[model samples]
Target: MTGPGRRRAGAAAAVTAALLAAGCAGEPTPSSTPEDNRVFTNPVIRTDAPDPQAIRVGETWYLVHTNSGGRNVPVHTSPDLVAWTAAGDALPELPAWADPGRTWAPELIQLAPDRFVLYYTVADRASGRQCLGRAVAATPLGPYRDDSTGPLVCQAELGGSIDASPYRDTDGTLWLLWKNDGNAIGVDTWLWSQRLSDDGLRLVGTPTKLLKQTEPWEGSLVEGPFFHRHDGRLHLFFAANAYDRATYAEGYAVCAGPTGPCVKAAENPILRSNEVASGPGHASMVEQDGRTWLLYHAWPPGQEGSTDPGRQVWLDEVVWSDGKPVVKGPTQGPQPRP
Candidate 1:
């Protein structure tokens, strides 16, 4: 995106010291850069940021990812991908209505300079109810508070919601997409969407079933539905399978129209990992400075490779070739958003 700004001198140094100490205690040290002139970058959001979402504001970049623990969801801000600092959680404490483990796929879209509408999967799994939830805050670094105590929306039992994402189309139509279990039909998971109210907290109408998995490589978990409009078409990107191996991938469906009965692109699994980076999915796409970037999580070689803690926040430049986006291999050094 842009070059990093100078931290507030002493105060930043102090906070950086505290965060670095907390980070390095059990986190992976900045990996060595490859000898082939690559860079070795540490972390932007070091925690288990399962669903990393990115957006660029003015010259500064902002990121938020899922915090399954119901703690404050993690947020990072920086001018460039390098030198990110903890901005603060959207909510340090969950609101009274938000039950335990309700936060998943915390995504933000800048409705205005100071206001943001965060869409997430908030549920009480124990009660067998799942729904899409919303929070609004005056600032990006949220202590986001939910105005609704009950679910903004809910679905059936086995269709328990997860991995939700947001997209605002060219016409200013707000859309929300989420995953519902597909185990019954023998598919991985199904992607569904609905138009959201202008405020983002209400549904304009019921969700329309968009696409399902039929490709062999996508496995049985066709989840993580996020739509990025490129060229004149819409690319619906999602994850498949258990996100713990190279097979864990991001698949895409191409729609001639923004909202569609789109077909999976022939390219299919557009973003998958190899031995270099495993289980890279649940990605968010942001176009900044005439460039596209995909922010997701993965297990780097020999570090945090265990699936126990699941995935962590990661970033890579998305190369455009033949109209589709190819997320490059893991990045070690900082790169401009361009």
Candidate 2:
């Protein structure tokens, strides 16, 4: 296993090379200059950082992903989103209800300057299903603590719940979106949403069923639901198909509100498998300098399930055309930086 120090050193060397090339080079050519400081290439994080969720706090960009490398929740940090350095595990210890080695899809939300809540999916030993849990910390890169005796959300009848993403609407209302793990038990997978308490430690009122898998490309499941409000509209983005297969892709829907009557876009799979990358889904969006970028993971072409490099992190530009988001990637070659 690679130590955290070694990972950081390797990332620093890559950044140094990128900076030097950008500084010394005159004009960028296809062969001579593939990447520069102003530009970047795919697989920004060339490790197993699947189900990536990123949040920008101040000027620093902090990212956390599914359990990998023996850590409960592997965390990384970036300044410009191109070069990333490993920051160790965010959730170092699991709660009493959770079983070890099954933590996944950690999503972060900052309520106050001193309060950060991390919602994560973990295996509930008592319920024998994957369930949702939340942890509290004072900073982005946290040794978050979950002291709850039970899960925050676990729809065991619908095969439990995972991929808990938090969203704060324009009206100052907080909502949580997630998918029932029905695919785990041969049932229908539905994206659901409900209001969250002000402190973000508990759910409020009743949960609404948002949407489900009906498109051809979606196959039997739809997970990783997140909300992005643009142009006075609430758009729900999700990943579908088997996560470990090349057919896994991303799509979106337009919703009426936080608890929506959502309509799927005509362009169902806005992002899908390409020659450069495969299984491109499970994304989080970040805005910097008025530009939107999608931070997601993809398998290297023809290596859909390899554990060596695993699902590496990739960044792509989200260009809005006629009020709809069009991802300009699974890009292989160099493109302008965020």
Candidate 3:
């Protein structure tokens, strides 16, 4: 963790770093009780970081996001979830079949002891399609490279697939979930799930459709499905609407098992645009210090009544009230950090 004084004196990049740090850099965080250490502010990182996904390795946390250009996926590390610093690009280069400047939603997961997997979406230039690819590395913060020259999954008929996420059940069954992008072709996006081999490099089962963009709040898209099992039920948190617009929001569904016959929660769009922020969606959830927290991207308040050009990453606590999950924010003001 970075000290308050040193963080305040660091460069402009340091200021962006402080926005995501644990304590208000020079201001004292309330420490009246053990819970006080979890208090911090929002807008964890004020840069254009979208579709943020994270994994906890031992005592450290590593996060990766949608980096369309530059190197492959970039990694950010933090001792406590509140303070984060750019580690480096996870994948040194793109796969030979995909084009650069098109990586989206890079997800990191540890399959076994020191083995980690990096799943991401990239655009194929030759075919003009978007596809999902997987890379492997020994460490969470990676210099991961694709073991194969081709993508692990691609939907040529439906155009392509994006937002690849892996879900491991209590029974140790690995499942891969992703969306077959149909928005451009005038068809609604479909969320699909299939079983993955133990190594996470091979698909083994039949693909099942989970949900699609049918609700009015979801607009024309429903992508980025995150899976979590709690209270004897499987919950899938997904983002809706256009990623670049103010209507983007997150909704969830409750399922009987890993592959369902799932049903959407009646109270849809659990997190949406509020007065302080806009376009809050495409989030990743993690458990830290025994509390669950959400990391998502939202556009800051725009100037002259126009939306901000870049989306910034924000973190908030997820509290279950009366056994139902609720997000504590879309907070613009300083709040307790995770």
Candidate 4:
């Protein structure tokens, strides 16, 4: 565990208007800071930051979280995983193709030194169906633009889709994994993946069905897919159950390839609610200093004096034993910073 160390201008300072380009609206707002980052604990941001996906650029870590119906995607940057500060919005302006006030679960990746791609979920006005779309930017924090006035993937027949996660194989093939949202139509939400062009802007093949909410522990909903590779096998981690419910948890599947006939662990939901937090799900994984860490969201224990709070981000270390991933907590007490 390390302290926040030295602070830099990019993340620790306020974003100026000149840093943003056209279509993006709003000046950067300051994020409230709490206790010293030298020795921090869990619930990293201490505020609502759900479905967080983090990307590392040198020593700095940038995180993007879901902002349903918000003007732009919220971004946070941390010198150390334990101490985070607000950077700015990823998309200064919402994509024109999407209905106003409909953005959700955003995943940003760098394709080249100056090329960046953002994958997010939004809704269509005609069908009111949530779908996945793409935006491009010159920098990590940016005024992103959706060049196409359309979605990259929208399966109206499957009740629409969301939570666009990406995986680049060792061979340089790009693959996208997402959940076919069937919850609105009284059907099971399913995880699906398809190959993409090297540019990651176009789908290459028919989507492959990976997993469904069949396990008793998975409850009625399963969304938020994030992928990683370990021991030469692909691991697909996803959030399950209604996010507001106590049963919300994190489960994973081990597969042979990017899109696969995956096998869910018999002992499912590697992470779940404990005595302190009620709902813990929608996780993103990052490896730092040879240790794997999981960043997730959970509703604080409702009876513990919180006012029915929404999901807030939490961080914990993950240890792999016997080819399985184990999370250290839903820990509420203070511990060493990660």
Predicted candidate 1: what Cα RMSD to the true structure?
7.6
CA lDDT, every model vs. true structure: 0.64, 0.83, 0.75, 0.73
lDDT of 2 by residue, 91-206 (tens): 99999889876777889999999899999998899888889999999999999999898999999998888999999999898999998988878889999999999999999999
Q: Rank the candidates by lDDT, best first.
A: 2, 3, 4, 1
**Residue 210 Cα positional deviation in candidate 1, in Å, after optimal superposition:** 0.9
TM-score attained by model 1? 0.81
The window of 10 residues in a row where model 2 has the poorest summed lDDT is: 1-10
Pairs that collide, model 2: none
lDDT tens digits by residue: candidate 3, 242-288? 76567778989988777787899998889998887788888999987
Best-fitting candidate, measured by lDDT? 2
Model 2 residue 30 lDDT?
23
Q: What digit string (tens of lDDT, one per residue) describes model 1 on residues 255-334?
A: 76545878887876766766556767778887766877777777564543353334566777787788877777565555
- The better-scoring model by TM-score among 2 and 4 is 2
Ranking the candidates on TM-score from highest down gives 2, 3, 4, 1
Give me the runs in candidate 2 sitting further than 4 Å from their true place. Answer: 1-35
Q: Which stretches of candidate 3 lie over 4 Å from their true place?
A: 1-38, 303-309
Candidate 4 TM-score, C-alpha based: 0.86
